[model samples]
Target: MSVESKKTREACCSKLKLFLASMALVFFAKAFGGAYMKSSITQIERRFDIPSSLIGVIDGSFEMGNLLVIAFVSYFGAKLHRPRLIAIGCVIMATGSYLIALPHFLQGPYKYETSVSHSISVNSSESALPCHSNHSLSEDETPDVETRTACEKAAGSSLWIYVFLGNMLRGIGETPIMPLGVSYLDDFSREENTPFYLACIHTVGILGPMFGFMLGSYLAKIYVDIGSVDLDGVTINYKDSRWVGAWWLGFIVTGTIIMLSSIPFWFLPKSLPKQGEEESQSKSTELATVAEQGNFLPEENQDHEEKEKPVTFQELAKDFVPSLRRLFKNTIFTLMILTYLVSVNGFIGMITFKPKFLEQVYGQSASKAIFLIGILNLPAVALGIITGGFVLKRFKLGVIGAARVAFAASVGSLCLLSIQVFISCDNAEVAGLTVSYQGDTQVSYNQQTLLSQCNMGCSCSMKHWDPVCAYNGMTYASPCLAGCQTSTGTGREMVFHNCTCVGEMKSPAMNMSAVLGQCPRKTDCDRIFKIYMALSVTGSFISACGGTPGYIVMLRSIQPDLKALALGMQTLIVRTLGGIPPPIYFGALIDRTCLKWGTKQCGGRGACRLYDANAFRMTFMGLITGLYLLSNMLWGNLYLKIVKRQKKLALRNQAKENGLEGESRANGHASINIDTNKDDTDKESTI
Candidate 1:
C-alpha cells in the first residue's frame, strides 16, 4: 500500500524485463554469428581461392580473440552501465557486417588490376615481332590491352579482398557482443525465468542462420546468362554461370545495421532479486524473531516486518571468481565441454574437406561440391534444431544427451556414406573410363509406367528419351529391367518408326561393369540433409533437455546461480584440453597420406580421397561411440553419487536444525519465566 513498496515492485519488474531482452540479444547474436560464419568460411574460400586449411585459421581467429577477451569484457561489462556496454557491442557487430559488404565492391577493382599485370608480361613477349622487334602494338592496341588488363585484375582482386575483409570485420564485431550481452541479461532475470528466457532466446536465434541459409541457397540457384556484349568498344569474356551472392549480401548488410541499432536498449538497467533469495532472507528474519521471543508466533499472526534485501554491485562483482572456480571443481562440466569440442571439430573438419573429397573421389567440380555441401548443411541444421528440441523435451534430457545421440548418429551415417563413397571411388580406379566401342543410341519407354506415379494430375515423362538398352536387359544409367520390343533389324522397339533400325544398328552401349561396381552412396547433405540434421538435432536436444539434469546434478554438488558461470569456466578448460590441436593431428595425417599416396593437386593416386573417406568416418564413429559410452558411465556414476550425497546431507541438516531450534526454545522460555517473576515481585513490593 505504501509508495516505497510500489516503487520497489515496479523497479524490480523493469530490471527483470531488461535482463531478459539483453540475454535474448546475446543468444541471438551468438547463434546467428555461429551459423552464419560456418557457411561463410566456404564462401570466402571460393571467392578468394584460399585453401580449406587456411579457412580454419581464419574462422578460428574470432574464437581465439574471444578466449583472450572473455574475462576482461565480462568484468568491465558488469561494472559499467549495462545498457551502454550492450549498445557498444551492437555497434561493433553492425560495423563488422557493414565491413563485410565492402569487400564485394572492392573485388572488382582487385580483379581488374591483377589481370592487367599478367596481360602486360604476355603483351611484352608477343609485341616483339620478327620484323618489328621490340615494337609495341601500334599505340592503339597497346592502350586497349593495357586498359582492359588493368580493369580485369582490379576487379578480380577487389572481389576476393571484400570477402576476406568482411569476414575479418564480422569476427571483430562478434567478439564483444556475446559476453557483454549475457552480462547485461544477468541484471534482469530472476532464477525461475532464467532457463525459460534462455530457451526463448535460443529458439529465436535459430532464425538468423535459417534465414541466412535460405537466402544463400536461393541466391546460389539463380542462373543468369549475360549474353555477349561489348562495353566501350571492348568485348567482355563470356561467363556461363557465376554465383554473385549480391542480393543475399545486401540483406545481410541490412540485418546487421538493424541489429546494431537495437543495441541502445541494453543501456537501461533491469535487475531484481530473485524469488529464492527473497525466500531465504524471509526465513532468516523469521528465525531471528522466534529466537528472541519465548514462544513461536502462530503461522497467521507471525511478524511481517521482513525487508527484501536487494543485491548490491559489490556482491555482483564477487561472482566472477567463484563462478569460474565451481566449473573447475565440477567433473560433469568438464565432460560437456569435451563432448562439444570434439563434436564441433569433427563436424567442421569434415565439412571443410568435403569439397576436396568430392572433387577427388567423384571427379565433381569444386564449385559444385561446395555448393552441394552448403545445400545439404541447411536441412541438417534445420532438422537438427527441430528434432533436437523435441528430443530434449520428450526425454527430459539435456543438451549433453542430445549432443551425444546426434553425434553418434552422425558418426554412424558418416561411416555408411564413407563406405559408399569408397566403393564408387574404387570402381572409378579399377574400371577406368569406358571407351565407346560403337555409337550410343537412345531408347524410350512407357512414361506412366516407368515413372511409377503422377503428382497432382501432372503426368511425369522424360524430356529426352534414351533408346539404348544393354544387351543384358538393363535400360538407362539408373538401371530398369523392363522388357522392351526391338524393331526387326535394329533390335529396337516399334514404339516409334525405326530411325536406327532401318540400317546398321549401333552396338549396344553400356557401362555395365562400372555400374554394378559402383557403391550406393549416402551423404550428409540437404537432399541427404535429413541425416546430418538428425545429428545436430540430437546434439541440440542434449543441450536443451540434458541441460536440466546436468544443472540439477551440479546444483546438488555445488551451488545454484553458478551454472552459467560453470559453463563459461568449462568452456575455457575444455577448449584448453579437448580442443588440443585437432587441426594439427589431422594436418599431419593429410600430409603423410599425401606423400604416401603420391596424390598431387586434386588428383594423384587417390591418397586424399582414400585418407579423407576413411579418416572422417573412423574418427566420427569412434569418437561418437566412445563419447556416448563414456558419458553414460560418467553421468550414471555422478547421478548415483549425487543422489546418495543429497539424501545424507538432507537428513543430517534436518536433524541438526531441529536440535538447534529445540535448545533455542528452551532458553527463551526460561528468560520469559524470569521476566514474569521480576514483574510479580515489583508489584507485591509496591502494594
Candidate 2:
C-alpha cells in the first residue's frame, strides 16, 4: 500500500477505536446510574414512608418510559445520526437523574418515624412518657384545632411523584444505548471481532453496577439527616430496618458522569468507513454480479441495498407491519424471544429484591448486603461474561453448542438457588409478633397479640412500635409493653428501668431494665452469611458464563437485515412485559411476608419493619427457580429445531448438486452428436 493509503487506513482504525471507547463509556455511565437506583430502592421506600409495592411501581417506571419510545427509536433511529441520537439520550438521562434528586432539595429534612420523642428535656422533674405525652389533655382544655392543622401540613407524601417521573425519564433516555450502540459496533467492526468487542462492552458495563452498588453501600452507612441532625441523638443504627441513607447524593454524581459522556459523541462523525472497506469493496463487482444472477448474496450486499433506499416517514410506516410479520415467522427466533422473556423476568425480580432478601433472611445490614453484591457478585458476572466469550471463540462453537452451554449454566444456577432455601438464619425474636414474652411461639398477626398478661396494666398503645430489649434477650413492642415506669438517660442511651416484662423470664435477680433497639443475632448467623456469599458468588459466575453465547445465538439465528429490528423487538417485548411487572408483583408478594408494618406520619401505612424469614426465602427463590426451569425447556426446544433445520438444508444442497451433474452430462452428449452430423455434411459436399 502507498503511504497515503496506509495513513488513511490507520486514521479509520483510530476512529473506530474511539467510537468503541465512547460506546463503552456510555454503557458504563448508564449502568452505573441504573444500578445505583436499584441499590437505593429500600432507602427511597423508607425515606418516603412508602410500602414495598409502591416502591416496585417506582422501580417499574423506568420500563414505562422505555415502552413509550423504544419501538420508534429502534426502527427509525437507524436512518438518523446514531451517535448524535445517543448523545441526546445522555442529556435526557442526566436531566432525569437530577430530577430524581429534586425532591430531596425541595422537601424538609428526613424525619424518620420514631416513637421516641426528641422534645423531652433530660433534666425534667416529671418522668416523660414518650408515647402518651402527645395526647395529654387537661381537664379544662380541649384539643387545639390550629395545632392539629399545623401538624398535618408538615407531612407531605407527594414528593415521591418526582422520583417516579424522573425514573421514567431515565428509562426513556436509556432506550437507545443498547440497540443503537450494539448495532453500530456490529456494522462497523469485522465479523470475527464483533464477539470480542461485545464482551469488552459488557464486562466494562458490569463494573458500573459493581461501583454503583458499592457507592450505595457506602452511602447507606451515612444517615439521611446527617448534616441537619445530631448523630448522637439518633437512636437507630445502620442495621435497623428504618434506616434511610443519603440516596439522593448518588443520583447527582451519576448524572454528572452521564452528562460528561455525551460530549465525546457530539464530536464524533455521523458515520465512519467500515474497518475493512478497502478490501471488501475490491470484491464488490463480483458480489454485485452474483446478486444480479439471483445467487446467494453476502450480508454486505443486502446492507448496501438497504442504504441505497431512502428512509421516509411514509416508507417506514408502510414497512412496519410487514417487517414485524416477517420477523415473527421464524420459529427459532420466536422461541428464543420467549426464552429471553422468561429469563429476564427472573433476573429483574431477583435483582430488585436481592439486597432486601439478604437483610431479611441472612440477618445482614442493608449496607453490607449491597456492598457484598457490588464487590462480589457483580465482579463474578463480569469475569463470567469475558470467560464465556473466550470459550465461544476458542472452541469455534455454533448455534447448538452455544445453546447447550447456556442450558447447562441455567441448570447449575437453579440448583445453587435451591440450596439457599435451607441456609437461612433464624427469625428475629420480637415480643408479641413472633413470640410471647414468656418465650413461647406465636403465629398471630393481629395487634391484640401485642397485649399480654406480663404488661396488661401498663396501658400501652398498639400503634407505637418503639421496641426495647429485656435482659433475657427478648424484645418488647415498646418500653410501656416492657412495664417500665421510669427511664434514665436520653436518646439512644436511654434505659427503661423497673420492667415487669423482664420478671416473666423467671430471673428475679437480674437487672429489670430494657434498652432501646432490637437485639443482634448470635455469632452463627454471621458464619451463615459468609457461606451464603460464597455460594452466591459461585452461582452468579456460572449463570453469567452463558451471557455472550446466548446473545450470539439470538443474533446468528436472525437475518442480517432484521438484526436491528429483532433486537429492538426483543427489548420492547422483554422490557415491557418482563421489566414492568416483575418488580410490582415481587414487591406485592414480598409485602405479604412482612410481619410488622411501619406507620406513616400522616397516619397511613409505611414500609415494612420486619419480615417472616422462612416465607420470604420461599417466595423469592421459588419464583426465580420456576422462571429458570421454563426458560431451560424453551432452550431445549430451540436447540432441537436448529439441528433439524441444519440437516434439512444439507439434504437439499446434496439433491441440487446431483441434478446439476446429470443435466451437464446430457448437454455434453447432445453437442457431440451435432458435431458428428456437421462433419458428415462437409464430407458429402466435398465429394
Winning model by TM-score: 2
lDDT of 2 at 57: 94
lDDT of candidate 2 over 108-152, digit per residue (tens): 877666655643335443455542334332311333667544554
Evaluated against the true structure, the overall lDDT of model 2 is 0.78
Candidate 1 least-lDDT 10 residues: 233-242
lDDT of 1 by residue, 1-687 (tens): 677666666665666565565556555664555455554443454444344445555555544544555555545444445456556656665565666556654443112101012222331223211111132323212235566557446545335444445445554445454444543343234433433444455555655555544444444333211122212211111110112223326336444644755654655642334332322222332223222222111112224335536546677667667555433444444544555555545544454454445543444433455445445544444444444445545565433353344444444444443333223331121100121112232212122223321111222112211223333222221111111211211111112111121122143323221111122223423243344334434443333344333332332232223433443444444443333344334444443332112111121121121223344434433444444445455545444443443454445356556675456446652111212113232221110
Poorest 10 consecutive residues of model 2 by lDDT?
289-298
RMSD of each: 16.5, 9.3
lDDT of 2 at 62: 97
Question: In order, what lDDT does every prediction score?
Answer: 0.38, 0.78
The model with the greatest lDDT is 2
Q: Which ranges of candidate 2 are over 4 A from the true structure?
A: 118-153, 279-309, 506-509, 653-687
